[model samples]
Structure formats: C-alpha cells, structure tokens
Target: MDPTIRNAKLQDIEFVLSGIREIFKIENDIFVYSEKKKLARNAIRDKHIRVAMRGDKPIGFSWFKIGDLTPFGLDYGKWSRKYCWISFVYVLKNYRNKGIGSLLYEDIMRICKRKKVKQIMLDVFTVNKKSARFHERIGFKPLLSIFTMRAR
Candidate 1:
C-alpha cells in the first residue's frame, strides 16, 4: 500500500531526527543529536513539515517554509508576495524508489496552490546528483550556483 502524507507533529520528533541523521550522513556533515533535536523541534513548531506514513510508521518527510521576497528587498508585489523554499525531502533507504518522496512533494504542491505561492525553490548539494535530477524532473530549474571553500 502507498504511504499517506500528513502534517508533522511534536510526537514525531524521533522519526524526524532519524531522517535528519540519515541526511547528514549522506552529506558527510557533522551534527550533534541534541542540537539537531532542538532544530527539529523548532521546525515542527514553526515551519511546514509533512511526513509520509505507512500504517503507523513514519517513512519519509519534507520540510519547507513560506515567505515573501520583500524581506530580501525584492518588493515586486504579487510576483514576490509569496514563495516557498524546500529545505529537505528524504525517505528511509528501504522505502525509496516507491513514490513516497513524490507523494510528500505532491502534498507540498497542494499547499502551495492553496496559498497561492508564486515560486518554489530548493538547494541540492552538487554531490547529490540523484536529488538534482529528481528536482529537474519535477520542473525545478537551476537559478544560481553556490560555491564554498573550506579552510584548514
């Protein structure tokens, strides 16, 4: 059976943390579980987060935020009135390739449409070609390239 998508709740913290851990592992980034937990709590409370559930188990999730571009000095009226930035979309390894991620995105799309969001944006790591391709397949175009240099 397919997973169902629903808004995340504080009760889902552990599952969300596990998903964040997996993402950090994939990115080779370091994180403290306690700190990540705090961020996850805040995300659940402040941002728009949705989880994919198969029965009672959480299998995947997507995180995003809605805001206006006017804060960034782009006061273009309706064009900049509303937008969405997808921060993360992840599925458990075992549940991947089964359309759970797409289902989560479909939920986000429905929310955006209801809110009249003008644009949706997201950042994919250069090393994660799979995610970049998925975004492209979903009609997301590259708007800018970001580069970073690590110092020793």
Candidate 2:
C-alpha cells in the first residue's frame, strides 16, 4: 500500500514533531523540546511541512524552507537561484525502507519545481549514514561537508 502525502496543518504539529524527534533520538542528536516547538510553529506558519500518512496516522514528515546563500558559504555567483533547504526528513523506524521517504521527497521536488528553485539541499550528520545514502539514492549530489569539534 502507498502512503498518502499532504501539507501539514497547524493541528498536525505535534505528530510532525514526534516523527522528527524519533529520528533525532536515533541519531543521538540533542534537541531542545522548546526549540522544536518553535520550529514546528514556524514550519506550519510558512506551510513548509509535509506529512506522509498511513491511514490516519503520520508515518513520516519533511520540514523544508527557502534558504539564502551566505558569502562565507557557497559561491552564490555560481548558482542561478536560491535553494530549497530540506531541514529535516524523518520516517518512522517501523515504516522505513518502504519508499515512504521517497514519496515525501517527491512532494518537495514538486514544490521546488513550481517555485523555480534551481537547487535543493540538505545536511545529514555524519553519524546518520543511512540518511546520507538515502539522499544520494534520490539524486541529491554532495555539495558541502561540515564538521564539528567538541571542546575537550
């Protein structure tokens, strides 16, 4: 059976955040609930969240937004238009590898196409290799690599 994709409404914030939190927990990333609450609010406000539902339950979601290029980062002159940044994409563990992520991603791609966004980008922590591979499989090429060094 195929999962249904829909734009997230204000009432769907909690479920979307829950799916995101599960992915973060599995990746061992520290996230403040308060901050997530704020992000959910903003994503909903901007209509940037997409949820994948299996029946009445949400099985995955993608939080995305338009982002600008900073001079310190990529060379904006090389790129023709602003990029759509996929802030997060999370699929329930039990529903993973079932093409659910692909379904959500296609929705984002359609949005980008309609908006004339020339590029789509996302960052995956090195710890989450599965996500990296998934993104690659979906035709997202490597553009940048960011590293973090914790204070000892």
Q: What is the alpha-carbon lDDT of model 2 when measured against the actual structure?
A: 0.83
lDDT of 1 at 125: 80
lDDT of each: 0.83, 0.83
lDDT of 2 by residue, 75-147 (tens): 5445546888788898888998889989998989898889888888777777888988998898988777767
Error of 2 at 54 (Å): 1.7
TM-score of every prediction relative to native? 0.86, 0.86
Error of 2 at 75 (Å): 6.4
User: Which segments of model 1 are wrong by more than 4 Å?
Assistant: 69-79, 150-152
